[model samples]
Structures are given as structure tokens and as C-alpha cells.
Target chain A: MNQSRNRLVFLALILLGIGFVALVRSTVNEYILSIINFVGIYIILAVSLNITNGFTGLFSLGHPGFMAIGGYVTAILTFPVSRKSMFLELPQWLANLEMPFFPASIIGGVCAAMMALVVGLPVLRLRGHYLAVATLGFLIIVQVLITNWDSVTRGPLGLNGLPAITNLWYVYPWVVVTVYVAWKIKFSSYGRSMLSIREDDMAAQCLGVNLFRTRVAALVIGAFFAGIAGGLWAHLVTAITPTSFSLILAFYIVVMVVVGGAGSISGAFIAAIIFSVLTEIFRPLEENLDVYGIGEIFTAAILILILIYRPQGLFGSREPGFLLTRDTQ
Target chain B: MASSNSVLLKVEGLEKRFGGIIALADYDVEIRPGELVGLIGPNGAGKTTVFNLLSGVLKPNQGRIVFNGQDITRLRPDQNAALGIARTFQNIRIFKELSVIDNVKVAFHIRMGHGFWKTLMHTSDYRYSENEMEQKSHEILELFDLEAIKDQPAKNLPYGIQRRVEIARAMATMPKLLLLDEPSAGLNTGETDELVKTLRKIHDTYGLTIFIVEHDMKLIMTICQRIQVIDRGRMLSTGTPEDVRHDQRVIEAYLGKSGHGKQYAQG
Candidate 1:
């Protein structure tokens, strides 16, 4: 009975997604559609980062590095031959390459996951703040490399004039997939093991959880989604650069996860949508009203207020169902 | 009575040190199958250290710990668990945020057959294993009289109940040998009596070789068939409970060597 209900809910979601795609495609205002697309991408980023930071209790600030890897890889792969020759200094075989957005984004995700595996082996061993600092260092290193690698990345000039392939059709499906995967894993034994590690490492280990292996797996999975989000963001903007994935973007994603409650997938999704909309709403206030940095100040205020009032974030490590009823009590 | 030749655990010359302080030195222990053994000593006597070494929470500088038939001296905690040895902590270490049922289900993780893909997709095999685990967890919870409160977070339970849940969680691993560290530490006399009954019932039902480190002399004396005494990281005595209770060296270690110390034993 529960399985059939789950299937019903999944079927309803797919139908809703189809309707949403049609709605966005027929909408006349491009600005609203763009905002919706950005929200979808942020949802993926926030939810994926929550898998490691919130669920596994591994505080990582390396999402920007993985995003940079994904964004650049997808951008390079999907760039037209004429555009690549005009901007990028590349090998003959490589310069002539082009692929569809779907496959390029997947390869971008794979590349990011591979990097996560390599970086996670050593960094995941560090606990708490040390782990956070090491990952932050990784983001900085990636940015620096991108800034200096002129032949491949065009150095500080950045890459532009790529196809604007990210829309509701591309972004919404990934949003659904990300939420579906996160929700499924959150209820599975693998998720329970991750949560156990978060609660208590020694006890979790005594319960037969391989700490390093679980931690690494969470990082790889989270990185894969972050990479995909980056690819989407790059195509939506039709440009790519090292600065696109700076510490600031990483901090915003982390804020979304924390403000949504780290371990709660629904919390991340809601928080991402709310924050993205707020950013857009406040954009006019900052630009038209000439209030420089007003949007950032407002975001900081909201975060601080949320921290003081509800330290566990809006959901406090609980699923959205918890709000429908007091099941825990 | 079990034969002395059918040994389940054998630890020889276990020595551990932390910089200048000797935590445990030249410790030797043996437990026959179906035996309930107790290791008792005063504070800082390395009782918990022995448990740490046996469960692979810490490695001894010198020792050979053989459990069942495997040399587990250098094994990791999860590896030791996989080899059919499980333990609880001195301080209650139940996963506080998880429900009572989940705390037990976590222990059943090692035996779970479903891989990542199957679990994510909720394949039929995954459903079967998960249902089996839930049924088994419920049975264990029922055995501990915790089934009613199984859905509540473990930390929300009372201290005595929390202790019971910890042991129940340990039992969910289906261990051949169980090591309990100060299981009766926070319990009152009534709770201690209940704990003793539960331990005996668990031992009998599971046919497990049980080793315990405890300070509650009453619980130990009432349940344990044999007792090993340690003081300042050295072995003081090893004998039947009645024998150790009457031994001069064991009495001396707990009550001191002087005649004035007799009051402690009586008290």
C-alpha cells in the first residue's frame, strides 16, 4: 500500500513537471522564466551539498571547485568549433569537438565526481573545521588554476558566446531527478548509515559502517549533482569563468542548505526557491533604487535572524512530512 | 556446565600504554563458550581498556586476542563487529537523534545484503531484507520491553531504558560474544536488578559468551559465573565469584591491605 502511494506521488510529480515545462515555454516574460530556471539549478546545488554537509555531517566548502570543473568541462565540450577557434587555443582534434547539452553535462558531472574521489580520500579524514578549511583550500586552488591556465580556459578573459541551452526543459527535469535521488537515498540504509555517522562516528563504526568509505561516497554523490548544476548554470548564462564559481557562490549554496536545515531535502528545496526568489525580488531594489549591496545585506539579515530564532533551520533535520503531523511525538 | 576446553576468547599478555602511564600491563584472560565472565576493578584499573582492546576500539601494544578462531588484535571496530563480537559503551552511546528502532537497525547493517543500487531503487530484494531487519528489530525491542516506545528518539527515553536500548542495539548484530562496559553504571538498585535479569536472559537465549566490565559488585556477583580482578593495570585475582569475594588479594585491592579497610567490604 505504501509502495503504491509512493508511486502515485511520483506519477503526480512527473505530471506536474510536464505541466510546468509547458507553462514556462508558453510564458511571454523571459525574466520570470530565467528566475525559475535559476531556482531549479540552485535547488540541485543546495540539495546535493546537503547530502555531504547536512546528512553525512561533513562540513565541506569545496562545491565551488567541483562546480568549476563541471562548468568548464561542459562549456569546453559543447562549444562550437568556430567559437572554440575564435576564443580558445586548443589541439586540432579537441577544437573541432562539440556535443549535445545532455551528454556534456553528464561528462561534466562524472569529471567532478572523479575529482571528489581524489580530493575526498585525504580531506575526508580531517574532522570539523579542519575539513572545512581543507575543502576551502581546494576551491581556491581550482580557481587559481583556472585563472592561470590560459591555453585551456582562456585565462582571466573567460569564455562566452556559448549556446543558451539551459531552460525549463533542461533544468526542471534535473531538479526532479535531484530531488528524487536525494529523497530516495535519504530513506535508504545508505542514508541511515550516513546519518549515524553524523550522529556519532565511533558508534556508527561499531555498528559496522566503514567511515571513510561512506564519507567518500557521500562526497562523490554530492559532487556529481553540484557538477551538473554548474553545467546548467554555465549554459543558462552562455558564459563561463573562474570567478563564476568563487567562494561567494559556494557560501550562498551552503547558506541555502543550512538555512533550509542541512539534513532535510525538502528544506533545501524550499530554501533554494525562497532565497532565489528573494534575490530576484531584491534585485530591482539594488539596481533601480541605487541601493548598492542591499540584497546581500538583506540576505545576511535573514540568515542571522533564522539562526537566532530557529538555529536548526526551518525544518531542523526533519522531512517535510513532519510538518504535516507530529509523528515523532 | 560448559567444558573449560571449549574456549571462545583467549587474550594473552595484553599490554597498553599512553606515553608514561601504563593503562594495562600483562593482562591475560580466557572465556569458555557459554560462560558469563566479569572483570572488576577500582577507578582507573584499565577495566574499560580491556574492553577497548577486545572490541578493536583500541590496539594494545602487546597482546594476542583470539575470538572464536580469528586473531582480532589488530582488527578495526567494524571488522571486529563483522567477526561476531559486539559491545556497548560505559556511557550510553545510543544514536540520540535516531528512533529506538533505527538504533537497533543500524547494527543489522553489516548483515544487510542489498547494495547501493538495490537500496536506492527499493528492489524486491531490498524490500525483503528491510522487512526482515524491521521484523527482527521489533522482536529484539519486544524482548527488551521497548517495542511500545520504538518510534521515539532514543535520547528521549529514561536513563535505564536507554541502557536497555543500547544492549538491545548491540544484540541486533547477532554477536557470538558480547562485551558490556559498565552496563549498570547509572542504574539504581532496582534498575540494576532488572539489568542483571535481562543480561542473564539474553545470554541464555542467545547462547552467547558474555564478558563484562562493571563496578556494581552486586550485579556482577549475582550474574557472573567467574570474576577477574585488576588493580592499577595489573591482575589481582581470577576465580569463581564466591572464591573472589573471599580471596585475600581481591579483598585487599578493593578494601586495602589494612584491617581498618574491612569496613568498605561490609559497607
Candidate 2:
């Protein structure tokens, strides 16, 4: 009976999502539609980062590096052949290549996950602030590498005028997938081990949890989705640059996770939408209203207030379902 | 007493040093299957160090640790757990943020039968394994009378209850040898008596080989059949509780080298 009820809820959610997508696509106002699309992308980023930072209790600040990897990989794969040729530094074999958005994004995500696997092996061993610093260093390294790599990345000028392939349709599905995967992981045995490590590493290890393997797995999974979010962002803006995936962007993503309550996927989703919308609404104020940097200052203030008043964030790590339902069964 | 032939754990010539100070030196112990042993020493006697070494929290500089006939001297903590050893901490280390049931479920992680794909897809195999884990966790919780508070966060529980949850979590790992460090450290006399009853019940039900490091003499003396005493990182005496109770070295270690040793030994 419970399984049937769950299936019913799943079907309803899919139908609702399709209806919402149709409504957004049919709407004539492009600006509002783009803002909604950005929210979906941020949701993906926040939820994925939460898997590592909140669920696994690893304070990683390397999402921007993985995003840059995804953005560049997708941009390179999907860029028109005619435009690709404009870059004289591009290799002859690569300059003519162009692929569908689907395959490019998949490759982008896979590439980011691969990087996470390589870096996480050594870096995930460090805890707390050290891990954060190490991951931030990774971001810096990626940024520097991208800045220096003149042939593919266009030497910090970044790729521009790429196909506008991302929309609400492309992004919302990825959000659903990210949320689903994260929710599944949170309840799984592996996720339990991760949580135990977060609570007490020595106790977790003594309970047969392989610390290195679990930490690395969390990082890789998180990187995979962050990469996908990057692909969506690159396509939505029709541009890619090293500065696009900066430390500031990483901070925004971290703030989303913190404000959403780290371990709660629903919390991340809600916080992502609210913060993205708030930033967009404040963007015009910063430009036309002569209040430069107001959006950033406001966000920083909100983050500080939330940390001071609700250290566990809005939801305090409890899932929406858990809050609604009293009994576990 | 169980025969030496059925020994579940054997430690020999164990040595650990933190710079100049020797934390443990020439530490030796043998625990047979189904034997309840107590390791007692005053502050800085390396009682907790022995637990740490046995459970693979720390590696000994010179030693051989054989557990269930396997040499686990260089094994990591997870490897030790996989080889049928589990432990609790001197300080309560339950996952405070997690639910009481989840505290036990996390320990059951090693035994989960589902793969990553099954878990992500929520396949029937995943459900089956999850249900089994929950049932097992419930059973363990029930054993500690924690079923009523199973849904509460572990941190919300009282100290005594949190200690019980830690033991339940440790047991969920399905260990053959259980090492508990100061399980009764912060409990009141009433809680300590209840803990003794619970420990006795756990030992009898699981038929486990338990090695406990405790400062509470009354609790350890009542429960442990044989006790090992250490002083300043060296073995002072090893015998039954009654024998150790009256041993001159054990008495001297606890009451000092004055006439109080004899006076205390009389008790």
C-alpha cells in the first residue's frame, strides 16, 4: 500500500513538472523564464555540494573547479565548427568538431567526476579547514591552468557565442535527477557510513566504514552534478569564462547549502530558488539604482544572520517529509 | 575459565611510545571465547591505550595481535572491525545528530547486502536489505530498552541513554570481540547498576568475548571473571577478580606503597 502511494506521488510529481515546463516555455517573458532556469541550475549545484559538505561532513570548496571543467568541456564539444575555427590556436583535429548538447553535457559531467576522483584520493584525507583550503587550492590551480591554456580556452578570453541549448526543459530534469540521487544516497548504507564519519571518524572506522573510500565517493558524486550544473549554466548564458566559475561563485553555492540546511536536499532546493530569485531581483537595483555591490552585501548579511540565529540553517538538517511525518514507518 | 586453546585474542610484547614517554610497553593479554575480562589501571596506566591498540585505533611499535587466529597487528580500524572486533569509546561517541535507530543502522553498514545501483534505484533488493537492517536495529535498540526513543536524535537523549545507544551501535557491527572503554564513567550509581545488568545480559546473549577498560571498581569487579591490572604502562597483575582484589601490587598501585595497601587489600 505504501509502495503504491509512493508510485502515485512520483507520477503526480512528473506530471506537475511537465506542466510547469510547458507553462514556462509558453510564457512570452524571456527574462522571468531565464531567472527560473537559473534557479533550477543553482538547485542542482547546491544539492550536489550538500552531498559532500553536509551529508559527508567534508568542507570542500572545489565545486568551481569542477564546474569550470564541465563548462569548458561542454563548450568545447558543442561549439559550432565555423566558430571553433576562429581560434587560430585550436588544434586542427579539434577545431572542426561539434556534438549534440546531450552527449557534451554527459562528457562534461564525467570529466568533472574524473577530476574529483583524482584529487579526492589525497585531499579528502585532510579534515575541516585543511580540506577546505586544499580544495580551494584545487580551484585556484584549475583557474590558473584554464587561464594559461591558450589553445582550447582562448587564453582567459573564454568561449563566447556558443549555442543556447539550455532552457527550463533541460535544467529542471537535471535538478530532479540530482535531488533523486542525493535523496537515495542520504538513506543508503554508504551514506550512513558517511554520516557516521561526519559524527565521529574513529567510531565510524571502528564500525567498518572505509573512510577514504566513502569520502572520495561523496566527492566524486558531488562533482558529477556540479559539472552538470556548469554545463547548463554555460549553455544558458551562451558564454564560458574562467571568471564565470570564480571563488565568489563557489561561496554563493556554499551559502545556498548552509542556508538550506546542509544535509537536507529539500532545504537546498528551497534555499537555492529563494537565493537565486533574490539575487536576480537585486541585480537591477545594483545596476540601474546606482547601488553597486548591494546584492553581494545583502547576501553576505543574510548568510551571517542565518549562521548566528540558526546555525543548522532553516530546516536544521531535517527533511521536509520527515518534518511532515511523525513516524519513521 | 575458558581453555587457552579457545583463545579469541592474543597480544604479545605490545609497545607504544609518544615521543619520550612510553604509553604502553610489553603489554600482553589473552582473552578466550566467552570470557569477560576487565583491564583496570589508574589515570595514565595505559588502559585505554590497550583498547586502542586492540581495536586498531593505534598501531603498536613492537607487537603481535592475533584475533580469531588472524594477525591484525597492522590492520586499520575498519579492517579490525571486519575481522570481528568492535569497540566503544571512553567518551560517548554516538552520532548525536542522527536518530537513535540510525546510530545502530550505521554500524550495520558493513553487513548491508545491496549494491550502489540497487540503493540508488531503490530496487526490491534495496528495500529488502533496508527492511532487514531496520529490523535488526530495532532488535538491538529493544535490547537496550531504547525502542521508545528510537526516533529521537541521539544527542537529545540523557547521558546514560546515550551510552546505551553507543553499546547498541557497537553490537550492531556483529563483532565476536567487544572492547568497551570506561562504559560506566559518567553514569550515576543507579545507572551503573543498570549498565552492569545490561552488560551481563549482552555477554550471556551474544556469547561474546568482552574486554573492558573501566575505572569503576565495583562495576568491573562484579561483572568480569578475570581482570588484568596495569600500572605506569606495565602489567602489574593478572588473575580472577578476587585474586587481583587482594594482590599486593594491585593494592599498591591503587592505594600507593604505604600501609594502606594492606588495609585496602583486606576489603
Candidate 3:
């Protein structure tokens, strides 16, 4: 009872923090609310990806590919009828189309999840290097498809004039719910089995874990959330481009999980926020100092520093509830 | 306990080949209920391969596996597990990164009754299941004398204790049959003796039907009620420990007619 109460108090504290931030945004003309919104989206993506990559021990390099599918689908589906009407080069069917925002967003997420399942069925059966290469190849294939497909994706020209619908209201609640779901999973038996599989697949298999089913479950789940994050990103930016969800995005998500601590869900949460803030704080520098790909250089340097210094990001594998002695399970 | 004279596991003309070499060929054995059966063979005798096939890790290009009187040839490994068959590895295989208790809890996952929503909601059923698994894992660990180290990471335990924990984790699932591969391997004489005692106690106490692959003949002779001797993947003979000890065919299979197999066995 005390532990459950502690969890409640912690949840209250997190809500308090988010409320304080939103209050501050409403009170002051601060420029960082957008950064926090980005952090929430990345947190959703990072925590979701960690479910598969960290917990299930599946090296999924196609996260950005799935995210891209979600972003593009949601962006196109939620494109206001006015904008759709304006694009003459677009198909007559698309120009006359109108998709309600929320349902379109969820459909976008489901599309991405379905893509994950379709790809995962064959790709996830492999192990180690083979799995990595297969996912990486899938990412490249998706990117190429998005770039070359002119009718729906608008080719390299990309889609623009999307509604900026993600605000403090949408992001905070979504982040909380996603983290809570992930926390529940981490403590649940499915989570335990997934973690055991991470530790040793052969051992887990002997203990009644179906490897294919487990991996697919984790993959579909993680991809579903990543897709949701993509929906948020598509609306928040008011533009959709293939380049946004690319290999570089994949690398960043990996950094969020690795620097956070592969086995730690909260680690991903904290690291995503920190990394997202750092990227924004350094954005001007990145734009001006594009000297020899300074953005990659800066990210690589931060990653190296984290690896050499903190090792397990801010939270490690210890959950916030455990830090407060709330729940043991 | 005598194996009810009723077959639990049957292998017939089972063969495994790796490219140019045949690892197991024309192997057959039957394990019955409530029997402490020993599978003993030389290093290259394909004893482990037989275990692998029975456990459904490797598919025989052709063969049928019937468990609990149900044909399960096409069943996956987890399906085999659900049907009350559990196995340990020849080399220690545990979820080394997890706590010992958590390792056992993982084995009890199929017992979960709650859906994803219940888990997500942290419902009463979810909490009950989690606590039940933890308590049961603790109880089983205690039974194996592993309670003190339940919080310890599995890899940190000593080899003998790790083996015991593996069996304990397997038993946590309440399997009808247990397969232990080299459970006594890498143990000192003292550890092996304790292992034999533990095995005998578990068999007598729980009435567990166990099939073990061990090179430790002393432990086998002391505890296993029956021994199956195999050479070149074919069963040389199956009998009581004493009967197999005197069988000339078993002697020649292990001794290669050098006339020193019995002396080697006495250690």
C-alpha cells in the first residue's frame, strides 16, 4: 500500500512538474516550450524503442523507417481540405479528401505498426548481425520509397502546410500515458519474459517463451508508439519530409536508449529530454557550423563523453519508483 | 520409483547430421513417469543431441513426439514447454542479468491470467499474479536452498549452485518431467554429493520424472534408478544401474576393448 501510494505521489510530482512548466510557458515569453514538446515526442519514441531494443534484445534499426511511415501518413491524412484543394498537381481524389485529425493520426500509427509486423515477421526471425542488417536495409528501402513516390509522398519536394496541433496539452498527457504503459509492461510478466529473453534467448525459450511471438509483440508495440510520436511530430512541425526520419534520426534514437542505459526505461525518458534540449540549444551552432558535418560531430562527441563519463545516463536501470522504494516487482 | 512401464517420451530412428558428419543416427529411447533415468555416454556419444531433439530445439527431419498422449512433432519449443516438458542446458544457461528470483518468475509467465489492459491498469488481478509469481519463485528457490541468493544475479552464483538454480527455475513451472543436462558437471566431489542428495530428495519428494544427461557416473550410479547407455547414437542397453555396470556391451562401448573402462569407472 505504501509502495502504491508512493507511485501515486511520484505521478503527482511528475504532473506537478509538467504543470509548472506549462504554467511558466503561459506566464513567460520563454522560447523553450517547443523544445520540451520535442522532448516529449522523443521520449515517447525512445521509451518505445527501448522496449524492443533494450528489453527484447532485438537490434531494430528500422525505427526511423516506421516513424517516417507514421509521419507521412498522418501528415497527408490530416492535411486540411484547403491545402489539399490548393495542390493542383495532386490527385483529384486527394484534393477532395478530408480526414478528421485524431482518427487519421491513430490510423497512421496503426499503418506504421502493420508495416512493422509485416517486416518483423521475416526480419525478426534472424539473430545478431543478420537482424541488424535486415532492419537497416528496411530503413533504406523505406526512405527510398518515400523519396521516389511522387503521387502520395510528393517525392523529394515533401509535404508542407500541416497543422501545428501538438501543444503543451497534447504532449504532456501523451508522454505520461506512454511512460505509464511502458512502466506497467516493465513490471508485468510479459516484461519479465522479455527481459529474460534479452538476458538469454535460449534460456527463455526453454522456460516457455516463444521467441518469434515475443519479438514480434515487442516490435509491434514499440513501433506503435514510435508511430504515435511520428504523428505528433508531423503536426508539430507543419511540414513532412523524408529527411527528418532518416538514418540520422535512427542514430539519435539509439543514442537516447544507449546513453540512457539500455535496460532502463526511465533512462530513455531522461536522456531523450536532455538530448532533445541539447540539440535545440545547439541548433544555431549546428546551422552555422555545418563545417564538415559539425552536427554529427557534435552528437558523436556528446555520445562519446556520455559513454566515457556517466555510462548509464541519468537514471540507469533503476526506475523512479524504485529510487523512492515504492515497488519491488 | 519405477517408470509406470508407461512411456512418456519416445524416440525412434532419430538422426541428426551436420553436413558431412552424422552426430546422431538411429537413436531410440523411452522415458516413463516417475523415473530417475540416466543418459550416460562418452564425450562424443551424442547424448546431448538426444536431449535437444526431445526438447524440440532441433527438428528431426522425420519423427513424431507425443507428450501426455498428444502428437507434438510440429509443436514449437514453447508449445513443448506448455505441455509439461522442461530442460536445462549442458552448459549453464540462465538469465544471468536478472535476479535469481526473477529468473524463476519468468518461467511462470505462461500462468499469467491477466490481459494487457489489466497489466496496464495495474489491476488487482495483475498485482495478484505478480506477487503470486514472486512468492512462488521464493518458495521454489528456498526448496533448492537458493533462498539466500534469490536476489543475486544468476551468473554470480557458483557453478554447482547455478545448476541447482536452473533445476529450481525449471521446477518452478511445476513441469511433469524435468530434463537436466550435465547438472553435475563442473562440480567438486562435495558439490556432486550434495547434487545427488538434492536429486534423490526432489525425485522422492515431488515424484518428479527426471531424465538427466550427466558424465558423472558416480552420481548416476548412486541416484539414477535406471541407466541408458548409448554408443554412436544407438542405445547399447537400458537396465538398473548394477545391471548396466556388468553389461559387457556397455563395457566395450566405454572401454573400446582396452580393458580399463571398469577401472576408470571406479573413481
The model with the greatest lDDT is 2
- Chain B TM for prediction 2: 0.95
Q: List interface RMSDs for the candidates, in order.
A: 1.9, 1.6, 1.7
lDDT of 3 by residue, A1-329 (tens): 57767677777868796877679678755366677778889999899999988888898888988888888888887887786655525677766777876777788789999999999999988998899889999999998999898877888878887888877677777677777777778777888888888888887887898888889989998888888788888888878887888888889998899888887888898888877887776777767786445656677898899889987666555566544443353
* Per-residue alpha-carbon lDDT of candidate 1 for residues B152-219, written as tens digits (9 for 90 to 100): 88879999999999999899888888999999998988898889889989988877889999888877
Where does candidate 2 chain B have its weakest 10-residue lDDT segment?
A: B258-267
Q: For each candidate, report its DockQ versus the true two-chain complex.
A: 0.62, 0.74, 0.69
Kindly state the number of residue pairs that clash in model 1: 0
List candidate 3 segments past 4 Å from native.
Answer: A28-30, A88-95, A287-292, A305-316, A320-329, B1-3, B113-115
Q: lDDT by residue for model 2 over A120-232, one digit each (tens)? A: 98898899999999999999999999998988898689888989999888998898899888877887776788888888888999999998888998999999998888899
Clashing pairs in 2: none
Q: Report the poorest 10 consecutive residues by lDDT, candidate 1 chain A.
A: A320-329
